[model samples]
Target: MSSATNSQLAIRTRSWMFTPATRPDRFANAAKSQVDVLIVDLEDAVQPDEKAAARGNVRTLLDAADNTALPPLAIRINSLLTRFGLDDLIMLLDAKHAPQFVLLPKIESPEQVLQIDTLLTAAGKTTWLVPMIESARGLSVVEPIAQSCSRVAALMFGAADYASDVKAQPEALALQLARCGVAAACAQAGVLAIDAPCFALHDAERLHADLTFAAANGFEAKAAIHPSHIESINTTFTPSAERVTWAKRVVEAAEKGAGTVDGRMVDEAIAREARRVLAAA
Candidate 1:
């Protein structure tokens, strides 16, 4: 997918699925899975020996017009601190195929975003960015990082790494503040905040609880570890039928000026929320 296509998808994305760049065959499957965003990981998911191979696979996958029919696609590069990162940038920047988004892992400051934005500009690419906040330092400066560059379309939370950094168990409640912090920063920057994936893919109850908690805490989307988790995440993040109905009612009443719905007042703010619910639905 091109960056233009990615820009549209970023506005209302809910389910973000990560597929390893090492497995190009899975790319088509991930695209067909109806995920809002499909990310090809070249970072933690790819080993040192496989980095070069994964980069080639990602380049070939992107170059194919047949692959462009997929959903909004992204490439998660290795950290700038590593040797592979510069090579990843050089190859991707010169590629004929354009990826809509570039996922930057372990982002710690706004300057890092600015530097990347500059390079992409120099290369004459319109690729957007998704900064991964994986540590305490990243969480602290997340707001600035989100606002650092216009190229940034979303902010992703890395729960496992963050949990380790804070010396806490990677539990829903354990990372509550961190999750909330990332969401609040995203809100401040007017960008999407995506929740981290639940490591235990088999725990359906925990997954549901995690989604519910993320939604309540203001995250607009969640990352999925496995393909099976996409549908549940999408359903959980989407506004319900009842919510859409209420939203319509609120909007209709607001159209008639000040009014009440079920003994409660319906004002501009309520109407706005209703509109948002309808949009999400």
Candidate 2:
């Protein structure tokens, strides 16, 4: 792909901050923050009876035809098997505008992704998708789901739900395999891999360690529950100045067929990575 197109992909996969659908009071603040995407949740964040009202809030955000101040918005809707999920889909289809992305939770098969894509296409909506793999079944189908459709903009690893599905504590080591699988699938499919949020909101040390681990594991972005975590997540994912300089040098040499940078061989694969790093920067 051209550098312009690559830049678009790496631009805003850094920090995704989620706000409870019931909490419209916080929506404006969340949108104004330095988050890459502001996710309005209609799933776990809302109580059963309050789902309708929560959906209404999401629709209201969509209804604002002249609001250019909103950030890149997304909605984490309930599972397709649930009634609320159906309602969420209906609301999106019936709305005047659609969120740039939709976080499809508990995705276990490519068919499910296809179903949503088909529904959106039939309605003439070009909304992209972010399929969240948060269970054993979901992880097992990560490759297929990542490759399911062009509408998939990214793949998110929902560690909390996956750990619960496996009856284990949500530790990094225990969830490493799933995280690796997700990252690999995303890399292969040319989509962003988003790390799940750290639950220990008060443990600064733990959050730092988690961020370090994720940045080294092929994850390009991370989700945050609180605004406090946004800055750290963004800093961890942003390519360093030194790295960006090296990437530029490498790509420059590769374009001229030098195949060598600072006495290191720059192959096609390495050049591609350099391009990605430049894009990320």
Candidate 3:
């Protein structure tokens, strides 16, 4: 891909924040927040009785479009098996504006991704997709799901629901294998891997540690339930000034034919990493 395209995708999802479609006022508030992506959730955030109203509200917000003042918009539609899923797609089909992305929850197979892709194609929409891997079946076939459709920009690891599905604790440590699996799949597919939220909203220390671990394990971005967490998540995923400096030095040394940098052996792989860091920075 071209440098411009790579840069666009890199900066597209550093801090993804979700706002309920039922609360249209919050959409404007979230748009102005520090989040890089704003997702208007029509799924779990809305109650059963409010599903229809939430869809209408989201459509109204889309009709009065303003991409300049808003972050990249996405909508988390309900699962295909759910009663509200078809309705969500129908609404999007007739929308005056299209979201930059659409997040599909509880994805289990490539066929599911293909189905959405087909529908969007038929509707003449070019929205990208972010598939949520939140179940054992979904985790097991994440690689296929990531590679299923060309429009998949990222694969999101949904921890809480995955934990419930597997009857495990919602802690990161407990879900380490699943998280790493997702990261590896996205990497192999050359797409982004988004980490799940740290549900302990009050525990800043835990959140920091979780985000750090996620970045170390290969997640490109993280989702946040509250705006308070956006700053930290964005900061954590971004290369720090010190790290950027070191990467530049390493690249310089490698170009000079030096095999060592700060006492560590430098090779083609390490040099490539340095270049990636600078590009991302």
Candidate 4:
């Protein structure tokens, strides 16, 4: 799809569920889930010996998926530096149907995004990109990376990998800086910023808490490792009635050329933000 077309169909992508690309049987079930995005993961999720089989399985699944109305489909390829990444790209080029996006894992610089963008262009594919920031280096260069690719639709935090990289607690304040950096970078580039998946599947309460924190910190969506977490992620990202009302009021004031709202001066910038909130809802 063209970049404009991709943007128009972009769901806020509240919850993205990762399904192992090696398992074709699970594709149908994943497509029927409530998750905003279904990510066919070829990295970490698949064994090294199964790479070839996984690629073939993903291709078959995508072929069959053409007739189904699915949540936005994405595939998380292994890092471009890996042998699996090259194989995955070659296989994707031969597929009858391409995924809506390719999630690049362990992205650490703008050069990587540009390199992939060049590769995609040369292959005559319009599949958009979503970079997964997993290291401190990735977070540091996120802004340039986001701006480096016109086809980039979002920046996703790879929290599990990031925590491991930095040797810090996942839910602690130490990681807040990196998270905020990613969110700010995405916002500056006018692309969606998705929070990392909460790994604690059994602890729904903690997941909810983490989702809340992510939302407050400017994440528009999150990744989910399981179907059970999709509902809560969706709920957390959705705008509340009060928030919607305020956004509406802000828009109304802007329509009337009013420059103030509730005793505070409002401008085109604030009005634009309000409209974004309403549109997201």
Best by lDDT: 2
Q: RMSD for each model, in Å, please? A: 2.7, 2.2, 2.4, 2.1
Give the per-residue lDDT of model 1 (tens digit) for 1-281: 13222235545488888899998778878866789889899998999999999999988876777765677788999998789998898878888877878999999999998898898988888888999999999988988998888888889999988988889987646589999999998878777889999887898998888889999988888998798889998898788888888889999999999889888799888897787677677
Candidate 1 matches the true fold with a TM-score of 0.92
Give the poorly placed runs of model 1, Cα more than 4 Å off.
1-12, 172-174
Name the better of 2 and 4 by TM-score: 2
lDDT of 2: 0.88
Better of 1 and 4 by lDDT: 1
- lDDT (Cα, tens digit) per residue for candidate 4, span 1-281: 33322136556577789999887677778766788889999998999999889988877766674645666789999887998898888877777777878999999888898888887887888788999999988877889987877888889989889989989987667688888888898888888888888889899789978888899988888998988888898888788898899888899989999767777677898898788778778
Worst 10 residues of 2 by lDDT: 1-10
| Model 2 per-residue lDDT tens digits across residues 97-163 | 8788899999999999999999999998877899999899998889999989888888999998999
Off by over 4 Å in 2: 1-11
Q: For model 1, what is the alpha-carbon lDDT of residue 225? A: 75
Ranking by TM-score: 2, 4, 1, 3
**CA displacement after TM-score superposition, residue 119 of candidate 1 (Å):** 1.5
Which scores better on lDDT, 2 or 3?
2
TM-score, one value per model: 0.92, 0.95, 0.92, 0.93
Model 3 Cα shift for residue 83 (angstroms) = 2.8
* TM-score of candidate 3 on Cα atoms, chains taken together: 0.92
lDDT of 4: 0.83
As for model 4, its CA RMSD to the true structure in angstroms is 2.1
